[model samples]
Target: MSGTLVVGASHAGIQLATALREIGDREPVTVVGAESLAPYQRPPLSKAFLHGSADTASLAFRTPAFYAEREITVLTGERVVDVSPTGATTDRGRHLAFDRLALTVGARVRMLRVPGAGLAGVHHLRDVADATRLRRALTGATSVVVIGGGFIGLEVAAAARALGRPVTVVEAADRLIPRAVAPVVSEFYRQAHERRGTAVRLGAAVTAVTGERGRATGVLLADGGHLPADVVVVGIGIVPRTELAEQLGLSCDRGIVVDRCARTSAPGVVAAGDCTVVGADRLRFESVQHATAQARAGAAALLGREEPVTEVPWFWSDQHDLKLQIAGLSAGHDDIVVRGNPDSERFSVLYYRDGALLAIDAVNATADYLTVRKALATGATIPAEHARRADRRLKEMLVASLDA
Candidate 1:
């Protein structure tokens, strides 16, 4: 039997390899990662890991012995520089032949293209190495200026505040996390962060990162204002890593294009994780749940089975003591129903488009999150009027709706 080569030692890559074994595929499997460290969890890198509550040893997904027992070959510190129909060559000039290929190569952080951005105190947290450097910088940082208001930036800001360092979040948008959340949710986070002593700047643009002696000293604003900082964190966004897919003549639109089954343009190749854009809807998700589900589908496709990734996408973020859980995609929502009071620090925002439920954003409300996730998965939705009743449990309401 021919071997299967999976590029990228990411959450998707490792999960795909595991799924292959679970599904009774006994072919030779190899996973290649550019980083020297073993496959590790990434979600905590911005939160617990940066906060010093979690360490490097705790980040690994599986032990080396697990791979060895599975008879899976894992090559770390090797970068694939070339790819073709039959084989791949690493930067160290080692070539591996395979009949099936999986491209789980994830994304890279989008750096701030400004003066002094490459200075000593400017950092971007995308991987363990980035988080390690930022954690070290936070130790000596008196004040921090975060250049984006996205999840990573806000999480880092919260961590900095927890570390007793003053933080100022500069967002170019009118509110925080606008792309993924509604305006009300965005406004709530802005106030929540401000209440916790993190200064948030909305509709602010950073023109340049000013430095002194090759180290970031402050950020110069487009409005001619300057915020002093000993450390600068850039968390604008990420660009999907698709160069290898493009090299192999696969269809790429911002990311490697894949079907619901995680099958790429090539016949014997599949892809998963943040590196892929799926379906004609051009849907893309960077969450672990999506990556794992898509990888399972990719594994099934590799074995001549037709399994499609159709699970409702879910995501979560922890800021200070608040845990925000989201279910479904809220894009193109024409209306929203607010359940409970935001001041109580426990509420859910349900999104609807043309009287159909689209998504729900719940803060410190796990029941609501789970209820909506189940409802969406089963194609059931609660009425807007019924959802407005904060006193009633969403699960009860969902059951009532299903019965009706």
Candidate 2:
């Protein structure tokens, strides 16, 4: 039997291999990862792992014995430098032949290019190793300045604050997580972080990472103001790892272009995870849910089976005691119906586009999140008028809509 070579050894790569085996495809499967450690959960790296509440062993998705028993070959510490339709070559000078190729090469941390960015106290967290180094640095850090107000930056600030280190979050935009959440939701998080003692500076443009003697001392703003810090964390964004896809002549627009089935431009080559943009809309979800779902679809595509990607995208972030859960994509929404009161610290914001439900962002409101997620998945939606009534539960509203 021919083999399948999965590149990147990420969440998508491991899931694709496991999906193939579970679906009764016994062909040889090999997963190649650049990291020396086995495939592990990444989300916790910023929260639990960084705070010392979780360790490397606790972050693993599966044990090495599980892969061995399933006859799946996982090669760590090897990077696939070259690829083609039939095979791939690793940086270690090893060639692996396969009938099917899956690319799950995830994104890397977008580096800060300002002066002193490469100083001794500057760090970027994208993987476990980065988190480990940051965690160690946090031990002696008197103050931290996180350059960005996205999920990673906020989480890192929360962790640092929990460690008794004074923390400050500087966002280039007017609000936090503007690209992902609605304005109301963004404001809520801004206030939530501020209430937790983390200083938040919005509309702040970073000019450079100020340093003295090759060690970061703070961040210099474009306005000529400086924020003092012993440690500087850059959580601006990430760029997709699309070099291999482009090298293989696949269509790439910001990210590797793929169809609903995770099929790339070249036949026998499929891609998934943070490295791919799906459909004509070019929608790219960087969460674990998208990675695993798209990987399963890629697995089916490899076996010549039909498995259209049809899963509602959901994501969550834990900042201190705040649990923010988001369902569906809220971009292009014309109106928002806020359920409950934001001041209560437990509420949801529902996004609507021309009176049609598009998405929902719930904070410390898991039931509302699950209800909206189920409604979106099943093609059921509550009317805007009905959604405005905060007294009524979303589950009740959804059931009423379905009955009507």
lDDT of 2 at 32: 94
Question: Distance (Å) between predicted and true CA of 325, model 2?
Answer: 0.6
Q: Model 2: clashing residue pairs?
A: none
lDDT of 1 at 292: 100
Q: Compute each candidate's TM-score over C-alphas.
A: 0.98, 0.98
**Model 1 per-residue lDDT tens digits across residues 95-171:** 99999999999999998998788999999999999999999999989999999999999999999999999999999
Q: Residue 118 lDDT in model 1?
A: 92
